[model samples]
Target: MANNQTLIPVAEPVIGDKELAYVTECLKTGWISSLGKYVTTFENRFADYCNTQYGVATFNGTVALHLLAAALNLGPGDEIIMPSLTFVATANAIQYTGATPVFVDSEYGSWNIDPAVVEAAITPRTKAIIAVHLYGHPADMDPLREIAQAHNLLLLEDAAEAHGACYKGQRVGGLSDAAIFSFYGNKIMTTGEGGIIITNDQALSERAFFLENQGRYSDNPYWHPEVAFNYRMTNIQAAVGVAQLERIADLITIRQRNAAYYNQRLAEIDGLTLPPNQDWAENVYWMYSVLLDDTLPLNRDELRQKLRAANIDTRPFFYPVHQLPMYDTKQSLPVAEDLSRRGINLPSGATLTIAQVDYVCDELIKILT
Candidate 1:
């Protein structure tokens, strides 16, 4: 989607020469399937980058989450806590394990899962906390970790959107018991479509790898030990991942740069709230998200429509999981609901030039002011 098209896209991948060369190598060697050198290399590279000990590559992030859930043996009578404001996949992954997803409200400062609310939600059956690094800002993990320790519960990160984002001084994927990341086409980095489980826990890492590969041992390929999934990432995908990882720093820097420019320009719009940049967190600004306060003449959807007319694409924040049909618990989470109503993701992608951003800002100013 990141191309020189007429419409400025909300997000796009930045593919380069290295990606093509690596992919070509996979094709030339007939190692297009999951069995190839790129898979292990990519896994090790990503794990090292995250300061973690292991990485189990998967076809996508959702399965990586489900894989972890299975490895942990979560099932009925267990509950997992997470913010209501995140994408529904977080809740679905828990549901896949037959575990209930206990929803919590978001904190105003980071628009992330609230630690105080998480503590309150814990019960005898509560098994873990899935702290999502929303939009690119890390959740305040220290308090959450404390609560988890106090309750004897595991803490995990759903860092699909916050690759390279830092909490305090550490990167997100290495901050918990285990974390997962999405390498989707529109993410900060891309492998076309892929994901991985990163962690320092030897037992959990071994379990995840075992479960992802149909639960069969290499020495006994003919014997099926347990029912599992074929969640392996393709060699081609890992090849792309390796190339993307090679220049991950540059991608992160560009996002932060774009965010800074957006902040300087769009900050002029009085009621538009800038994305969070905490003193202890390094936000990668994946989407350059902003919230539309009542002071603006147009609501979020209306402004999005006008931006559409101007050939600029944008995305509204996700509806809280509790509000969605599958998980409609009738539980009132005021902060998550409010942020979902007001937040919007602007054109934050590799293909978006400074000139395109200027056009977006000009259009917003003309329409809102």
Candidate 2:
């Protein structure tokens, strides 16, 4: 177990001296709670980065999604459409608001919600569509936007995996009516553990902010008129986030470089299909995934085990939410089901080196051959 097969984790969070120093500074300043300069600074800077008019920081990404559902007033008897291939949070957010989540399948190529399926799922009760840009790839927003427009439904972007990504030259966070971003430990960007909701509408922004901070108005922090959850991001966490935001461009560039290397090295394998991107999409490559053809000698789990045996770390694709225990009542999503069976996540942390990438690809190819 101690030979060349030492594990290379699929993702690693980078917390350099800058982040630590900022946290120390925040601690010394006695402004470590949610109400501090760093928290406001982080929100402002992140809003600017997303090119949106406002950003409301939350404790984590799930809270952001919940807040969005609440802010949009999606509740019992309403319906929301989203891809079943995403993290369960996407669907659970709807359930939190007492709304039903209509699961849609992914397009075979990009692993995003298929527009056709979305069109088919829309009904009179459909109030919104959460177009999640799964695994850092931008969903085809143009057509989805058209569909939403035609039906008079809100299009919300779940850009949790797509920081720094763009669709047709527009930033992902501001491309839809409202967008949510996650800064989880393994995400493309990190605020230690935080999220932001971006919007251009002042009223929506105000509602989102209010919901995020226990429904307390900025004018009267101590007085709460409505019941709201405490989802505010702390100043200490925001300090780390501000530092991470400063280096996001560089982080995205490195991830792109690593993904390109993987593509170049693994493109020749007979059993694998690489990620798909639209001509107009500026993908940030949050995670580099591959699909295993059934014609291949080995299946996805077999390939993953072989790689793990060789010290390379990889992850099996997300299990479609429809298949999960809690979502057994949801409708079937064939495309998402198929992708879940075929896909695998390769090592794609921000700190992955060229040599490490080569090692992962080399091991992957060896198993297939």
Candidate 3:
């Protein structure tokens, strides 16, 4: 243990002088509300970047999902097919719209929702399928879209963890009827706390805007309208988002390089599995996950403890949502259950250095081997 050594973090947001100066300018401009210039500018820029017609900014990623559910008119009689291998926010958003989230297992290759299972889950009441591109790996979109089309279900992409990811030469955020992105502090891109919904449908985009700003559609501020939640992103947050967007290319590059190092070093280790990406995907890994097979000398939790003892931070894969106390609805899933037990997220952030990645991989390999 040395005082000179800096701890490598599992996820860290890189906030620099640009963000600071932008925030200071926002404060001085007295346009810190949801209607500020930066908010409008950020929306336009992000929409253009994604090659979509519209982008509506929200307070955070969850709000974006909730708005998407509402925009699609998903309700009490509706059901959503999605993976249990995602953050609870994915399920919670569907729940907010009074729709049931039918959880499915993860794909063996990409660790995203298995499109095969999503098709099998389709029913008369299934109104949507939320395809989450987990950990910056673009979920196989074409097959999922085909399934949704067959069932006449809406297709939504929860690209919150995949800001710069692409699939089959198309960007993640513009792939579905509606796609949502998060600008949470820990994501590949950050606005401290913000999100956006992108779509090519004019009606859906307008409805999302209305829902995001409290369901008001009038130009007059004093006009009252139907009930809607307050999910608007402030000008201050948009200002920061604009700065982050400007640097997304560089951030993605850093993430790719760090992920490559982790994959190369950890791939050869017995019983250790790296995050999987398909050939068509340009992965911008938000977190580097390594699976520790049970056949290994130590289980997942034990290895985490061993790594932590060496001052290395790691996170086990999310506890499958179906296994959570609230979601114990007797859903039978074998793959998600197994992957959840074996997966571990290594330190992967835009600010991470090669030396830090090497340190993490070396320590992990040392323990696992």
TM-score against truth, every candidate: 0.98, 0.97, 0.97
lDDT of 2 at 119: 89
Per-residue lDDT value at 253 in model 1: 85
Worst 10 residues of 3 by lDDT: 1-10
Q: List the residue pairs that clash in candidate 2.
A: none
Instruction: Encode model 2's per-residue lDDT on 83-127: one tens digit a residue.
Output: 999999999988999999888889975789999878889899999
lDDT (10s digit) by residue, model 3, range 1-369: 221156667889988888888889989988788877899899989988888989999999998999889888888988899999899999998898888999988888899999888877888888888989988999999999898888788889999999889998888989889899999999998988999999999999998887777676677765657778789999999999999988999999999998888888887798877788789999899988878777899988898887787777778889899988977878778888888888888888887888788888778777877
* TM-score top scorer: 1
User: Tens-digit lDDT track for model 1 on 248-305?
Assistant: 9988887788888888888788899999999989998888899999987889999999
What is the TM-score of candidate 1?
Answer: 0.98
lDDT of each: 0.92, 0.88, 0.87
Candidate 1, overall lDDT?
0.92
Question: If candidate 3 were superposed on the true structure by all CA atoms, what would the RMSD be?
Answer: 1.6
